[model samples]
Target chain A: MSEPTADLLVVEDDADVRASLERGLRLSGFAVRSAQDGPGALRAVHERVPDAVVLDLGLPGMDGVAVVSALRAMDHDVPVCVLSARDTVDDRVVGLEAGADDYVVKPFALAELVARLRALLRRGARAAPATTPELGEVLAVGPLRVDLARRTVHVGERAVDLTKREYELLVVLARNADVVLTRERLLELVWGYDFATDTNVVDVFVGYVRRKLEADGTPRLVHTVRGVGFVLREGG
Target chain B: MRRSPSDSTGAVPLSACSPARSMSLRLRVAVASALSATVVVVLAGVLASVLLAREQTERLDRSLVPGSPAVLGSFASTRADLAVTLRGPTGTVRRVSGPELPLSPVGIPTSVTVDGVDYRIRTAPGPTPGSLVTVGATEDDTRARVAERQRLVAGVGVAAVALAAGLGWLLAGRAVRPMRRLTEQAATLDDTTSAVRADGSRESEELADALSAMLARLHAEQERSTASLHAARDFAAAARHELRTPLTAMRTDLEVLRAHPDLPERDAVLDDVLRAQGRVEATLTALGQLAAGDLPDAGGGEPVGVADLLRLAAEDARRAHPELAVVVEEPGADVPESVRAALEGLRMALANAVVNAVRHGRAGSVVLGAHRGADGGVVLTVDDDGAGLPAGEREAVLGRFVRGSTAGGPGSGLGLALVAQQAARHGGGVRLEEAPGGGLRVSLALGPDRAG
Candidate 1:
């Protein structure tokens, strides 16, 4: 695949790390603009709309999560890939929840980060392509159903009051029913942020979904990959 | 302490502090043995005393009572005979051969009593009724003698019993003495350092077995934990190896771009790339060092001059944080020659300390001193003027990745922790103390240790 000519905005607090990432990304052929902090990143975004963002979670001024949230509030949909030195599983989950498209744990292999960036960009490109099934603003699947437009859900024939969070979580799952969605990807799509709050909100909410679904034997789903992460499967 | 046997033995309370099972078992055995023997001896002595008194009384009574009838039968004899004579309903005669007989009681009987020289007499039918004769004297004296013998026997028996109880106690204490010593030794032992095996006699064989079993379990746990630690280090090393290549390439590229000034985007791109590469490389470096230090200062460095180490360390700190006060306390600074290099390592560790003190610790008197401890090893103390690391995190800050909030710059945060590791490797340790003027004081102790 050819590198995109559109520029990529890289936001990080550490000058040395920000510089290295831009150099590598540019070498891979993506045009890169660098920002040392959140204000700089947001300013850069306004100055020129980039194809994607490479954001660091531990920014000095406005954190990466706040920056993503602000951009989302402004109705921007540029794909984001979070880069941070905190490699913990919860950290990855937190970053994704803040609207990041993908994340790389620090001390991460550069190759892995590059691969992650490519995957996220590929997803964005496919979503825009007319040939790919354009998932409607609302979709429902089996007994586990979602209304993306209303941002709500229903289990079987019962109207379950889903939280804004739960509704968004269900929409992501419904959009890719029967497809295994990594916990990071799920968090990114639902939470619209790129950092974890150290809360087991992911596992907790998954348990909630399972509990609600099993209230009347509505079939089981949401399988976990032990050491990896969570994946939502269909019945059985 | 009491001057008595009681006060002389503080070991009593110390023994009481021993494990409850063995102590209780010993006490139970003592009580049971004493009780069983006491009951047997007391019952047998009482029965024997009663039977012996009865036998002696019977001998005196039989002779005295029979003679009464004989004396009565002789009542018709001559007055000069001085013997009493009497005739019963049949042709019976009663006579007492002795002259000292007291007047008997009025009740019918074949009996006589003698008090000193006086005599008393009485007659009674024998098994054949009035056909019996009675004669007796000195019966009163005889009964008094019999009573005296009985008293003597009872007194002797009481004394014997007291002796037996004392003897039994002595035997029980003597038998349990070795066991008490075994218990005392067991309680004082620090199993964390060296192995301890139970050594007790056959009587205390059970106690020894229990101790040995527990020690064996302790040894097994220590071994398992050591093995697990090695496995973790290996795993970390492997991870570092796998993550190093791309990080190297990224770093190289950034360094390359920095050398070229013509490209407009080169500098910007190089800055971000280098930053990323640095994080990756720093992580790898930290990981590798942590794994390598998994086995701390195995025996390395001899007694290097403490003064030399301190001076070298001060120079380093001067370069790192020249603004901070780095003063050496030369009083009683006798650093052993064997720990010279170890002290140098200490200085490196302390340079980090000085920098941190300069950074986070208040800029106060940073005293670095070296001296010999009471245990015959050199001790070095580094005092910083910064607010002391919290007591809770004093030990924790020495762990990998954890650092004080005062870590403002992009530091590796491995400095203090590495110092701890180095000290540990050298069969020594580092401690967190409150400095004289209220700041963080880290004392490093190093002696001899084998390399891991």
Candidate 2:
């Protein structure tokens, strides 16, 4: 809170690669610092207290995943973004689950890494910072309702628990009730990718949101169109 | 469907002469034997007929011509339908016959009779013309005929010929048919599998069995060839891999040294190392390509331009061994790209031939020529007009690690083998023989897509 701008920690072993990254990121308008190995990277975290870290999976004295797990165990949700050269599905998954905010493969563009880091920073910075409405004041559905400011949901007199992606989808549908919302349009407005409607991500997530809302014979809100898309409707 | 190797158990080995055009063995033998036998039998019968007629005529002339028994002395009664005749002087013998004859000076005797019964007879003079004695008898009629026993003998001969022809056909079919197939299988004998067998096992049992056995043996040989080929490939790969490590280390060390600034005195060492590296790279690349089943000129394309490739290869030679001389001798329309690549590779191979010659002999000119071969194939001849390879080591040089007695320089010993390999890839090979003007001639002749 005392600093006007945030800091970024880069953990990699190869001196050539480390120098290349540090030079690139410094030019990219981020106050960047580097660690030669894994042990040095963890120690830098307490001293400098950076806004985010760009980490590598392969390390010398300490393992990269163990470092990430140790940081997360201390309840430090500082949004770490992993950068690795390993091109494998397992490597990405392990990085993400170890509390990395996002992961990028190496030989990646400098602009792309900077953009992803900015997105992580934006998440922490953009919190409305204004008069926010409470749940049930702005949203309700079929004896079920949500209060966004209060961070709670109500079904008649009861409440429910929903994950982040699920809550966002339901909120969009409840706000635009009784209207035909194509999966593409929903992905654009809610998930921020209209061009990626070809994926089944929309259907999977909608199903989860619908299940939570209709947990015990409550009224339904999500409707599916055969071979077309989905619509948010009430009572029909 | 993918038939199991075992499922090819009853494959018949077909041959080139397997009744494809000519008559079958059985038919040919049977027809010839039967016809020959018939001819002998018929000729014998005609000979017997002629001999019997001559002998009977001679015996009649001997008895009747000299016996002077007047044939007119026994003339008795005469009638239009009935005539009585008398024989002379033994006793008066009278005969009744069919008709009266007009009086004539001479008549050829047909049949004569005595007493009241007719007889088969013939007339003759009784030692003189005036006194005629008929010495003919009924025996002549029987002798003139084809006899029952002779007919029986002839019939038996004909029957024997028929039986012999039939037996010949069956036996020839049984014996020679399988042999034909066996020969065919042997000719086409790709010795690749275990069950090299002939078809129709039960019908052509003996032949099929023998053929199957032979094919099985040949197939065993084919398997041996395949195994040797695999072994060659593995050896090439292993040699390349093993040799490349040391070569790379050497090259890398040399490269590192050349990068340093203060090596003015070590220029000769650096140049030699670089040249050596180039040679090692070429060798390793060739060996690696060979091991990977991607031989030089492997793409079966059209005839390549011989002149262009030769020129290009000469450039390469000039760069590598500037001291050596390369000459191109050809005057024809440009060849195809495939031929060009092949000829290019061969040119490199031949350059080595000249390089070896130059390194050994005090001096020599390697002349390369291209022309249309007698077989309509593009012929390329590389000749080194120098101290040639010794007569005893002619074939030895084409084999691996076999350097000529004249060779002294340190080489990979794979140059000629590479040439041989490249020639083989083009469906041809290299021949080392006497040159036109007293030197070694290495003529690499390409065939019309046939493995010559």
Candidate 3:
């Protein structure tokens, strides 16, 4: 009855699952559009970019990972949450590596998926206006640097490319240099996920940032403190 | 008396019970040779001593019976070790030289001890008539010589025994080198090593061959079990993945219903939930059938008539789908009356094919037919005038949990997979081809060996 909070796209190969998700998301206060495969999902996005996308990893053609890669290639910063039927760490990692913002295993609680999507959309909203800050602030830790106004990163002389989630995670770590940030704190600061969940999206994004930062064999700027969390400092 | 338990528990007693078992083969061989050598040498030494003593006594006896008494008396005086005793025929000592001699029997030499001295004495016919001469010699000389020689022989015997033990040990070590090498090889045996070889004695070679054979068999058995375990694990993972999709839909539908109690189209939402539930149940049943088919055949095959099979399948399809028409085509003349096959399994496979055509293909009619295959086998076909799959997807749809792109409605993707499984079980295959009248045709072939 009320205006929808956001526009969401549901891409799943299973028609029953896709229909159920479309209806549930619509009832949960989002204008939901559904697609049955990866290419259909991309066509829908081309027609009108949604606020967030819930994509199944096991699509009939192109697959969810390929779709995410294509979306990232076109510089579409829309938030994406993957739905994976396989409960393997490798499968989830592969999706995240392909630029998925988050993931939930199949047969998941609708409430959980809804919560994750909301967090992703909120983060996307906050990141949109980050390029027009009043003052151009630069956060530097050792050789790694983040340009807040321009929304870009460089490690020494080399320009480091990063996805939206990876950039956000690195910016959070660089802003609080030399300070140990727990996994829960990082998830809140970077992913906008306030509630407790078992997702490892924070660690995955941090891995991406670290790999891009250390691409030229630069000494690691982000160090993992065993059993605690991570810290960005000049020396390990 | 009762033996103490401690006696049995001691290490010494345990080793002593079967010393040969604990001893090395080389050491055992050496000890046996040493014992035999000692026995032979000691026996030869004793015999030589006895013969030498007798020969010395006979020489002394011949001197005692000289050709005349004059020579006898002179002979006795020349040798101090020889004491000549002249005894009368009445057996009384008449004359004596050196130590006194005891009178002894005539013509026989004997050992006598006199004044704590050993002597060899002999009595024979004297030179004078009715006179007997007895020669008494101190056997101390002969005894001493024999004793000395015996000591020398004993020393030689001991040396021989030591030499025999040393030689035996060295030879036995050489003889068992192959066995020792074999033992070392066996100790290092692992999964990567395929065979063990010991090229020496025939017995060692035979042992190595047996060991290698046993290891190869174990490796094959292990590989087979590992492969089957992997197959079962993959099947379980796929089943879980298939079941989750429907379950996800059902859960979402239920949550929506519970969230909006009075929303319009509530019945339709409830129907969706029921349909999803039914899909889950059907998927589970199909998965169970697939798992059962994976197991080795359990003597289920029987002689089944080809015509009878097609008729039964068409009847079952008609009964299951009352709205659709089912037709059974007559078998060709070349086709046999009976084929060896698991009747129940074939029936199940055909039923799945029919279900696939009706549910996914949306067929109006299905024709069941049979004919003799080109490979001397029987081929059963199901032709449907429904929406058929594209040529590219027909082959991919045969795999487990794979559904064709054109699949419509809600059905488990395991129907054609079941048909494929039965085809493989019957030593044949399944093929999907375009039907004669712009429909889909599924051909299930049974191997030539199954034809009767």
Best by lDDT: 3
By lDDT rank, best first, the candidates go: 3, 1, 2
Candidate 1 structure lDDT: 0.61
Question: For candidate 3, lDDT tens digit of each residue in B1-452?
Answer: 33356646643443324423467889988998898888898888788778877776676556544445567678878987777767676867777777777767767777888888777777778877778776777766666777887788888889999999999999988888888888778767788989999888898889999999999999999999999899878877888888889999989888888888987978988888998999999988888888788887767478999998998898899899999899889998998889999887899999999999999999999999998899989999999999988999999999988888889888778999999999999989999998875789999999989999
lDDT of 1 by residue, B318-391 (tens): 77676766787773734454453455456557776776677556565588887676556777788877777778
Instruction: Name the lDDT value of residue B163 in candidate 2.
Output: 77
Q: For every candidate, how close is chain A to the native chain A in TM-score?
A: 0.66, 0.59, 0.93
Q: List candidate 2 segments past 4 Å from native.
A: A1-4, A36-51, A57-103, A124-236, B1-452
- Which segments of model 1 are wrong by more than 4 Å? A1-3, A129-138, A141-145, A148-236, B1-410, B413-452
For model 3 the local lDDT of residue A215 reads: 83
Return the interface RMSD of model 1.
Answer: 6.4
Q: Write the per-residue lDDT of candidate 2 for residues B154-231, one digit (tens) a residue.
A: 787788788778877877776666555655565564435333344543445566576677767777777799998998
Sorted by DockQ (best first), the order is: 3, 1, 2
The global C-alpha lDDT for each of the candidates, from Candidate 1 onward, is 0.61, 0.59, 0.85
Question: Using Cα atoms with residue i matched to residue i, what is each candidate's TM-score against the true structure?
Answer: 0.45, 0.32, 0.87
